[model samples]
Target: MRIVEDLRAELGDRIVTEPQVLQAMRTDRSGWVGPGTPAVLVRAASVADVQAVMRLASVHRVPVVPRGAGTGLAGGAIGTEGAIVLDLSGMRRVLEVDVQNEVAVVEPGIVTDDLAAVLAEHELWWPPDPASRAISTVGGNIATNAGGLLCAKYGVTRESVLGLRVVLADGTLIGVGRRTVKGVAGYDLTALMVGSEGTLGVVVEATLKLRRISRDPVVTIGATFPDVIAAAAAAAAITASGLRPAALELMDAATCTAIDDLLQPSAEYPVLAGRGAFLLVRTDSAAAADEAALAARLIRHAGGEPEVSTDALTGERLMQVRRSAHPAYARLGEVLIEDVAVPRSALPAMFAATERIGASHGIPIPTIAHAGDGNLHPNLVVPPHLAGEPGHIPDVVWSAADELFHEAIALGGTLTGEHGVGILKRRWLADELGGDVFALSERLKAAFDPLNILNPGKVL
Candidate 1:
């Protein structure tokens, strides 16, 4: 397209049209499958630059795929065949911090953790922290309406957003939502942008609500069981007890082994080799008696051995091990990460079905979960050497996971809880949402992007 020629001249050598550049940006952390090359890559600096690119794409009838740090696990930032990748990573900035109002306005490329660090200096906190917070951008989180460990109490990204500045497909910039505590706003476009997955418009900036930073003492609880089903049962029971914990996580035997190898833990029994899966639950309070007693009762009822920890450093160390799961699994093989979620009661069945799927396919699928919120991550380890063949173990494991994905939908659950449905889950989206719902979503997409030049073939 001649638009590529215009972008090259406008953005100078920063605009990359080379084959290798296209290849690198076309895939994300999910690694579901490689994607087709984008015709051009425009690394935008200022909002004006973004406006220029959007205007050109609109005029030329070219697709524009908006991208942040490329840390997305669901391929949300991936480009389509012969499209323009509007890379927003260069626009990182803290535009404004209204400390009095308890809000911060930032550009889309600002990392979640970085924003948290800045907020920490002011004794403030932004609570929507996904696992990839250190690398993922605020815009990506807004697109997916991400949920995280604290979601059981704090809610997801949707509840935190107060205002948004979105650039529509036709290059119209509209501000939505109010900065004040509450308002009966018009259609609530700010709410609509959350979890839209870039199909509607580009999120240029956001004003997010903040909470007071706390230094409360934390109590950690560790519970082990012979299988994932028992642990899931314990998780559900703990939530049912009404004692909300800071974090409720589960790690399978394989994952524990991976963590042990990576951190070289000196525990008497390796974290994984304790004979089964374990639950790591944390509460951000010094009053551990209530939380600890509830956890113990639930764990025992679910057929688990429970241990409550009051030591801060020891609990922190164990939480570190839990957070290291993804990187450790990456070292073992090519990772096929599934972010499927089911009802709280359906978790035990989901775990059982996952184990059966692995065994049936002769593939070992180690699992983990943010159990408090019923978000399950079943990582399928694919050995690099065996990649690309139809008979590869990774491919087999992925097929099994696909079956589980459909099963979750059948049980009135979603294919993804936190991770957005990028190209990886595009085919099954209709199956989950159905024909009429899908058509309504498409009509909304058309209303916002009449030219159909924004992140084509992603969620529709």
Candidate 2:
């Protein structure tokens, strides 16, 4: 209560104590709700506003939950009870664009896709495009160190981030990283903050490295296989053969079916209809045509029927199917999205494991993958009766997720690929990181946030 008064006094009308607003902020897209209601929500309009909130929170020893567009799928941006919801979505501004240097300075709240559109005018591009780019913010992507369809070639958000201007737990503003193309000056604190998920500090600004938009003709290859295993194998083969595609995505039989069903009678090309599994590949380099042809050969070798196209609209339509996987699943019932990744060579095994786990659990785990990088998003569709509330996940679902997480770990993979270890996956983080390393991570977290006031009860 005292913290709320302090926040209101410092922030004036920017402070929101309305119960409805607080309730709306209690959960992110993760479907995992916080245990209690947020004490207040602050619509931060600038870096100074963020600093004010954090400074007051530190003085009161109150928890501060930094939030972007609330598109996080790992509960990283969820607001907790007695915590200040530091909403940064309003601070959407592009401060500077150094086109000569191929770098841009931007506010954290700028939408990923919006930034891309702005960059396009300059003939530049930022390639870390998550499926939720239309709504997800740059800050949220940086918080999770997000990867997307093109990650196999361009890498994740961290690779493009040259530097960060962060507000520490004590509200001290500090800048980390460099703008130079090459610098090995000190510890990579910018890298450390990239995936810290708001546990270390609040990211107010980022200096991002940009690339010139490719002018080469784009080639898209759509392939169908007997099953997910075959499609995953084809993807693995393409990766092994050193063919770098701008994007490589795989959708299992169930995912294809769901997307097909969603795009019914008026659908122009029903390529996904009755398909067992589908692979969407795109190559946009100088040798895109040659690379796509070789990729098609690999697909054929893997027992798949491949269709290659150079039409940009056709390519976008195919990509639309891949991007529509989650919404199609959500139409069925309550959806629990799971992010797990394995080595490229182990993709088939992981797909096989999902089949077995889904059968054992008696739940349909419709999966899609950024196959080029071996990251799979398995959607657990829980019927209305079983899925009671928005944030409530049944015990059986958790059991299945536990088995899936262990399976990934067994295959020399990780519990999460792009999504950070928010409340949803924090339980298994120790299993993946081991005891000693996990303990050291906690110590490092303490060194940055001694009061444990930054995103408490999250990411260790």
Candidate 3:
């Protein structure tokens, strides 16, 4: 490209046009190939590098897709044809950790766990614990408004964000939100940008809210029920009992069996061994032991064998398995993870519908969930041979997914709970948001990015 040559000449090796680099930067972790490889990969070293790339892209009318660690599962960071993959992973820097203000300033490229580690040194922590914290960037977490094991109690990334430094599509840099805790200054543009999927603007840096770690509870509880519905019943009971557990997770038989098999047999992994459906509950309040005891008795009353533990190490190992649910599903085969959420009271009905869907489709769909919040991840696994066949793979999986998504909607639930509606779920956005709201969302997108060059086909 003659237009790209100028960028190459000016940026030197910073602007990558090599085929291998382009190929390597093409897709995200969505398990699907992009429509086409990127034309150039810009390893942005600073905010200025990003602004220069955006400026050039705006002038030439080329698409620009902002990317962090590419650990996204929704294809939000995947590059489009002839687009510039603006890689921000090179800009990692923790600028400041303000204990007095309970905030930390850092570049977008910093890994989520790294920021948590830094805050831990100051006796403070950020609680959003996405399973991919080791590999996912804070920018990507903010982009998707990620949730994790502890999110039901601690809140998601959007709740923890204080401010953002974003580069608009036309190369304009601006700050949104505030460093302080309270402010109703305007229309909450910072919240708007938090989950825009890089379609609105490129996030360069962020001011993150932190919290002091609590050691009150020092106890964890585990239980196994006859099935997912029974486990969900126990979860609903726990929630109804007014016992505020910090984390509440659920795993079905298949998910637990696979995780148990992958980890091999061990005494510490009994939470996953021979458990048809399991629930993990943790509390950090002063009533920790009481909460665990009450929760355990409720699980028993709900027809489950309760496994109570004050041993932190054993509980941590079990929680690690819950965190590894998605990865364990990946080991099965080609998978499409469905992020569906229903009312807590309707979880049993949701599981019944899921079972019916699996039975009807003849697809082995393993489910794991943040049961406390009623968010379930139903993983559709396709065999290797079927994946290569024409139409069989997506045809089967998508048909089942359509049924499952509609079931969620029918139950007064949502298409996605934690995962944003990226490429994979864009077609269903209108169905979820309805005509008027979805149309307003389109207007919002146009207002932020008129040319639709930022993350071209994601979200609205």
Candidate 4:
């Protein structure tokens, strides 16, 4: 209470201890479990405000949670008891854009889509287009090291970031990385900080690497397979054939039905209806048409019907459906989103295992994948009637999810591809890293925040 009074006195209305506001800031999109509500909410307007909050929280040895837009799939943005939620979504500003040097300096609150729009003006682009980019913040993307459809050709958020302005646990502001294209100075702390999940320090600003927008004509290929295995095989064959597409994605039978039923019940949107598996492949290469033709042929070889399109509208509609897949499921029931990734070659195995797991667990799992990269999001749909009822805990659902995670690890893959290990997956992280490596990770956490004040109970 004294801390609240002090914060309100110093920050005025910027520090919100109101019950309603605190309740709203409790958790992010990962609604598997409700969060322990924090006592203070600081809507940070500038770097100086963040510094002030961090300084006070450090002095009092209170936990601090940094949140951006609350679009994160992981529970990384969930606030804990007695903590201060440092909301950075208010600090939206594009500080600088070095066109010649191919870099843009931005505030943490800037939305990914908004930044892309600004970049378009300079004929430059940022490729980390996560499905939630329309609402996800640049800071959140960096925290998760997020990857999207284009990640197969370009890379994740880590690749596009060059420098970061961070605020340490003790409220000390420091710049960790360089803005130049190549810099091997000291340690590569910038890379370390990118996916730290706001545990090591808080990101205030970033200098991001930009790419020039491609002028070559792009082609999109949509295909349907008899089963997910066939689609995945086609993806593998495409990759093996050395015909790299700009983006390659897959939606399983149940997912295709769900999307079609939700978006276009009367008619098929993107022609995804009545398909056991759907694949969308896009290429912006110099030989874009040739690559698309080859991809279509590969689809045929793998027993799929390919639908080629050079029209931007139709292709974009296909992509829009893929992006909207996750949210669309939320309308049906309690959607337990699972992020598991395996080797591209082992994709067929992953698909098979998911089917077996779902059958065993008696849960309906609809999966969609960035097939080119082997990242799959399996939506475990819990019927509306069964949700939040007494003794109806979705432990049965997680039992299947447990199998999915282990299967991914066993197949030389990770429990999470783009999403970070927040509260949702921390239980499995130790198993993935082994004891020795897990201990070393804990040491890194200790070295950064001796008091464990920054985003406590995350990552490590």
Q: Which candidate's lDDT is highest?
A: 2
Sliding window of 10 residues with minimal summed lDDT for model 4? 384-393
- The reply for model 1, stretches above 4 Å from the true place, is 267-270, 285-288, 383-386, 389-395
Would you estimate the TM-scores of all the predictions?
0.94, 0.99, 0.97, 0.97
The per-residue C-alpha lDDT of model 3 at residue 177 equals 89
What's every prediction's RMSD, in angstroms? Answer: 2.3, 1.0, 1.6, 1.6
Residue 58 in model 1: shift from native, Å? 0.6
Error of 2 at 313 (Å): 1.0
- Name the lDDT value of residue 206 in candidate 4: 97
lDDT ranking, high to low: 2, 4, 3, 1
| Tens digit per residue, CA lDDT, model 4, 46-92 | 99889888888888899999999988887888888899999999998
Of 1 and 3, the candidate ahead on lDDT is: 3
lDDT of 3 by residue, 1-460 (tens): 8547867876778988889888876666767567688888889999988888888888888999899998887778888889999999988899998999899999999998888888889999987888888899999999999888888888889999999999999989999989999999989999999889999999999999999877675678778888888998999888888876888999899999888777774786774656779888887788888888999899999899987888889789878878778778878878887789999888889988998999898888889888778888888887576686321346778899889999999999998887788888898888989999998998999998888888889898
Q: Report the lDDT tens digits of candidate 2 across residue range 26-97.
A: 888877888899899999998899999888888999999999988888898899888899999998899988
* Whole-model lDDT values for every prediction: 0.83, 0.91, 0.85, 0.88
